[model samples]
Target: MEDKKKILLVDDEESITRTLKLFLDRRGGFEVRTENRGSQAVRVARDFRPDLIVLDVVMPDSDGGAIAQDLGEDPELQSIPIIFLTAIIKEQEIGGHGKAIGGGVHTYLAKPVEPDVLISHIQERLGV
Candidate 1:
């Protein structure tokens, strides 16, 4: 059998992390790990070594954008794909757009994201 795709989900909300982790693991057929603190993202990413990262934009300790920047600067972690799950931009605001952002690895997905769409994005990115 093929190796299950690994994903690291970083968000400040326990409920959000819990739900997404369960959904992605059970329904999406992927291995999922989560961190509720943005400040710990890089550390956890180094340990988990995820194939992709699902990140939240805003957090109390650290912001997702900053975490992304840190990840990009790290040679071992720079190539990982990051998807921003944010409430800052609504789904309609981007015209249902979910594309990689300017930095060349990060993608954007508005919050309250539907599970199916999220899974589709994950599969598309992983080519699974």
Candidate 2:
């Protein structure tokens, strides 16, 4: 059997992480791990070694940008792709389109994202 794609989801909201983890695991053909505390994301990612990361932009502990920077600086983790799921910016603000921000190191999706859209984005980024 082929190895499954690995994904790490970091969100302060336990509900969000739970929902996404369940959805991705059942339907996306991927191994999913989730961390509810933003501060712990890097450590968890280091251990999980996911092929991609789904992050929340604003969290009480640490913002997604800082986490992404930390991951980027790590040679072992730098190649992983990060997609930011956020409500910090309104849907219309980015032309109502999920845009690839941060020079493709990150992609931004509005909060209340549809599961299918999120999975599609992940697949596209992972080239699956």
| Per-model TM-score on C-alpha atoms | 0.92, 0.90
| Residue-wise C-alpha lDDT for candidate 2, range 1-128, written one tens digit per residue | 98999999999999999988999999998999999899999999989899999999999999998888888888888888988889878656754345443334467788888999899989989999
| For model 1, the run of ten residues with the poorest summed lDDT | 96-105
Candidate 1: residue 18 lDDT (0-100) = 97
The candidate maximizing lDDT is: 1
**Clashing pairs in model 1?**
none
Sliding window of 10 residues with minimal summed lDDT for model 2: 95-104
Measured over all alpha carbons after superposition, the RMSD of each candidate to the real structure, in angstroms, is 1.8, 2.1
lDDT of each: 0.87, 0.86
TM-score of 1: 0.92
